[model samples]
Target: MTEPRTPKWRALADAVRRQIEDGTYPQGDALPQLKPAAEAAGVSYETMRAAYKALESEGLVRSVKRTGFLVLEAPGRRRVTRDTTVTRDPARGYIFPAAARPDEPWQVHGRPFRALVPAPAEVARHFGIEPGTETLRRRRVTSPAGEPPFQLVDTWISPAAVEDAPQVAEASTGPGGYLDRLEEAGHGPIGWEETIRARMPDREETQLLAISTAMPIVETTIVGTSAQTSRPIEVTIRVIPADRVELVSKLQRARTARWPVAPVKPT
Candidate 1:
């Protein structure tokens, strides 16, 4: 009697791994044709394709139509960063107002607006604060000027500064944006610092962000403080897909006031 056959897809993936180890398909070598591999492995074309998918998930090979599978030279993670104007447009000569509150959880066009919960432990540590602290968390999904949402952003702010303002407290009932509240409270943030890092997403984050399991994430942690006082007040963490979204920060120099001195009397 003939021995039972192994699953075709798993067998194919094993063959590719062997090729890598033996240098038959050295780093950066093109993968063997799937059709031919199917024949060689005594597997159907569909099963062979499934094998390729497995390799891709392991970050072993990349496939592009007409390009076949190419072994990535370096097998490591990646991150992307872009400098965008704070305002809608740089030429407009206007600063982008700070995000103050959560938008109504209604659909704009077909896509629903987003919101965020308070900071988790790692996020809270970035801001030098305790977790579960009373902070304003905002979330939003933004699309290109005329496209579907390609990016998601979540930010956190302390209530210490804005609690006195009715509009700030009312965010729970309506749309609450941060910059607006800051302006109303007489202590608008004039400066900020942003720290970003690349990392893999956990299962829960992957579901919430709605990203592919194969993709990585870039996390941006921001600390916004009062420009006048130069004191830290709020810290925020935003997770973005590595493929989408760019972070831009433009800082202006603070001007020193020139106090007028009484003219000295000449003897």
Candidate 2:
């Protein structure tokens, strides 16, 4: 018996996928119309449409009515190095290079969403406060220009921290942003602990991130402690679209190393 031939639509889809992967038709580029593509590929118009539909299902392209199919900027795998060193200035509390880069390609916009709600059990534990304590929550959606937001960060700070400095609760917190205000209020962060996990996004997250349900999300929890007092002052939860960004950490081996220790016998 002879082997079956590949479907025209599948072959067309594979060719388009290769072009996208090789940057021949870069992200945000519009693809040829179904009729034109069909003529060029020597296939029926319906076959070309099927190929485009396959690409859409794979998250490579999206079709807009009246408009042609547009390529999507599918996030490629990247290793984002985590900086362990804490760089601070008297004028500008803590400087995080990864959080905000001055020379980024895309423009960043931070929109604040404020709420005063009781702290959850995990949040309270991180904040070193009892559950149900009324906390000032500040949520910000950071996005690249003309694109879906990259991350949603919810910060919970003690009411006392923002008591003297009301600007901390406001939407616009000046040039230095929230951390600067916190430092001026005498609750600058001296140390922080971060825990990262991967999970599926909820409905609200899917809408805000503008991502499909199949996409996974990266959740990072950061707890910041006061410099003056060792008490926890801020707890921030960041939700990152896994397809858009990657988290990387670099660890150094200790200089004093011992090798080839004898195996321990039964105790």
TM-score of each: 0.50, 0.63
- Clashing pairs for predicted structure model 1, backbone only: 99-178, 100-176, 100-177, 100-178, 101-176, 101-177, 101-178
The residue-by-residue lDDT of candidate 2 on 1-267, one tens digit each, is 998999989999999999998999898788999898899999999999999888876667766557778777775444567876667655555655354454455444445678789998988887677899888898877755565567787898877676756787887788677777877787754478878899988877765765545567889887878887787778888988776676677766564444565567998
lDDT of 2 at 96: 54
Best by TM-score: 2
Please list the residue runs of candidate 1 whose C-alpha ends up more than 4 Å from where it truly belongs after superposition.
Answer: 1-81, 84-118, 126-128, 145-148, 169-176, 245-267
Which whole-number lDDT from 0 to 100 does residue 170 have in model 2? 85
lDDT, model 1, position 2: 100
TM-score of model 1 relative to the true fold? 0.50
What is the lDDT of every predicted structure here? Answer: 0.58, 0.76
